[model samples]
Target: MQRIIVIAASAGSLDPLKQIVSALPVPCSASVFIVLHVGPNQAVLPALLGVLTDLAVVHAEDDTPIEQGHVYVAPPGWHMRLETGRIRLDQGPKVNHVRPAADPLFISAAETYRERVVGIVLSGYGDDGTDGLLAIHESGGLALVQDLDEAKVPGMPYAALYGDHPDAFLTAEKIGERVAALCG
Candidate 1:
C-alpha cells in the first residue's frame, strides 16, 4: 500500500523544511503533502522547495491524482486535503485562523488513509497542527514531531506533546531519514 506523509509548519520553519526536503531520497517512496502558513499572494514555496529535492514539488490543485515520489504543497490561501487517491484544494473558512492551515490536511489524511498515514509537525508557532496530529495518532498512523530543542519555534511541537505523544522526537534531518525508511 502506498503511504501518505503530511507535514505542517509555520514561523521559523524554512530552514528545517529545507533540511527535510534535501534529505529525502530522490525517488521517495511516499506521496508528501505540506501545509505551510503563507498569505494568498505568497505562493512561491513550491519553487523554493523544488530546488532542494529531486521529487516534483508543486502547489496542490483540486482533484489532482495522488502520485508517489511527488510533494504537493498547499497553495497560498487554500486548504489541501487528501481523498482516497486524489488531492482536494479548498478555499473554505480559515482553520487555526489561517487559510492554508495544517489541521484540515492532517485530519483529512488521517481519516482517509488511516494506518497508511504519517503526520509530522515541525517548527512553528501556536497549535495549529496539534489536533490534527492527534487525529492521526488515534487513527493508528505514525505521528512525529521535531525535537523541541531543535525547533526554532517550539510552540507547535510542544503542543503536540501535550495532546498526545509522538512516535519520535527528532531533528528535521532524522525525521526525513525515518520517513524515507518507513516509506521504503
Candidate 2:
C-alpha cells in the first residue's frame, strides 16, 4: 500500500478542500498529509479541518509518528517533512511565496517513500506543488492533479499538468476514488 498526501488550495479554498477531504473513504490505509496555504497568524487548522472529516485530523507535530487513517495538516508558517515514518516540522524558508509550501512536503515524501507514495495536487494559485509532483513522478510514485475545469483556481493544477505530466488528471470526486484505490 502507498502513503497518500494531498496538497490542496489556499485562498478561496476552504469549502472545496473540505469537501474533498471529507469525501475520503474511512479506515484508509494511506496517511493523508495536507498543505493548505494559510496565513502565519491564523488559529488552529486541525480543529477546523477535523470538523469536516470523520478521520483524525491534526497539525503536524515535531517527530510525530505518521500513521495510516490519520490526516495531518502542516502548521501555519512551517514546512512539514517526512523522515523514516515520522513527521519533521521545520521553520524552513517559504517556497513559491508560501510558508508550508506543497513542494517540500511532496519532495520529502517522494524521497522517503519512493514508489510507495501517492501525491495529489488540488486547486490553488501559483506553482507550489509542481516541482514536488515532478519529484514524485521521477520516483515512480503516482502523481495526480485536479482537472483544470474542476479547480476553483486552476493555476496550480495547470502548472502541475504542464510542468510534469501527472498519472491522473481528475476532479475532486474522482480524486477521492483514486486515492481510495491507491490505499487499498
Candidate 3:
C-alpha cells in the first residue's frame, strides 16, 4: 500500500524539517504532508524546504491529486487535509490558535488513511499535535515524536509522550531515516 506521512511543527522546527525532508530518498513511494505554524501571509516555506529534498515540494492546493514522491506543505492561512486521492484546503476555525495547526492535518490523515498513515510531531510549543498523534496511534497508524532532549521546544513532544506514548521517540534525523525505511 502507498504510505502517507503527516508531520507537524512550530517554533524551532525549520532545521529538523530540513533534515527530515533531506533524508527522504529521491522518488519516494509515500506522499508527505506538513503543517508548520506561521503567519497567514508566510508563504516562502515550501521553497525553503524544497531546496534540501529531491522530492517535488509544493504549497498544497485544494483538489491536487495525491502523488508519490511529492512533498506538500500546508499553505499559510489554510488547513490542509488529505481526502481520498486528493488534497483539501479549508479556512476552518483554527485549532490551537493556528490556521495550519497539526491536529487537523494529522486527524484527517489518520481518518482517511488509517493504518497507512504515519503521524510525526516535531519541536514546537503547545500541545497542538498530541491528540491527533493519539488518533493516528488508535487508528493503527505509526505515531512518532522528536525526543525531548533533541527537540528545540519540548511542549508538543512532551504532551505526546505524557498523554500517550508514541510508537517511537527519536531524533529528527532518525525519524527521517525510520520513515524512509517504512516506505522502502
Candidate 4:
C-alpha cells in the first residue's frame, strides 16, 4: 500500500509532536512527512524528531525519492511538496502566515496520493492546517484533528474541525494509534 502521512503543528508543539512520534510503531512502512512551523534560522527539525522517534528522520530534499520507513521534515523557510513519488521543495511566498505552511504539503499530498494520504492537524496557533485538512478530506484522503481538550494550542485543530469535520477527532494517544493502524 502507498501511504503518505502529513503531520502539522505550531506553537507548543515540540513536546506533543515528540510524544506522538515516539509512540508510533517502529519500522513503519508509511512515508511520513512533517510540516512544523519553525524559525528560518532554527536548528534542523528532522534531527530533533529523529532523536525522539525510532524512525529514520531526515529533512526533505528536492527531487529526493520518497521511501517507506523514513520520516521526512519540511526544511525551515520552505514548503514541501509531493510529485511523482518524490519530494519537491519550494521557497515560495508564505501561505497562511507561514512559510513552511501545512496547507501546501497537505494539498500537494492530496493531489499526488489522493486516498492514500492521511492528514493530521495537531496543536497550533492560527488556522494553517484548516484548509489543508479540508483539501485532504475532499480528495478522498483521511483527515484527523487533535481533540481540543488535548491540544496545547487549540486554534489549528479547532479551526479544522469547525471548517470541515475530519474523519477522526482524536487525542494524542489515539492519534498515535490511528497512525500506527494506517501504517499497518
Tens-digit lDDT track of model 3 for 81-124: 88899999999999988999889889889999999999999999
What's the true lDDT of residue 87 in model 4?
A: 95
Return the TM-score for each candidate structure: 0.97, 0.92, 0.97, 0.95
Candidate 4's residue-wise lDDT over 1-184, tens digit each? 8789998989867776786788767778799998999959875778778887778999888999999988888989999989968999999999998889999999999988999999999999999988888889999999998888888899998899888989988888888888888786
Candidate 4: where are CA atoms >4 Å away? Answer: none
lDDT of 3 at 96: 88
Model 1 whole-model lDDT (C-alpha atoms): 0.91
Candidates in order have lDDT scores of 0.91, 0.82, 0.91, 0.87
When 2 and 4 are scored with lDDT, the better candidate is: 4
Span of 10 residues, lowest total lDDT, candidate 2: 4-13
Q: What is the C-alpha local distance difference test score of candidate 3?
A: 0.91
lDDT of 3 at 83: 88
Candidate 3: deviation at residue 92, Å? 0.8
- TM for candidate 4 is 0.95
Residue 59 lDDT in candidate 1: 91
> What is the Å distance of residue 116 in model 1 from its true position?
0.8
Using TM-score as the measure, what is the rank order of every candidate, best first?
Answer: 3, 1, 4, 2
lDDT string for model 2 (47-138, tens) is 87788767899888999888888999988898888887899988877789998898988998999998887888887889988999999999
- Per residue, candidate 1 scores C-alpha lDDT tens digits across 126-173 of 898899999999999999999999999999999999988888899998
The C-alpha local distance difference test score for the whole of candidate 4 amounts to 0.87
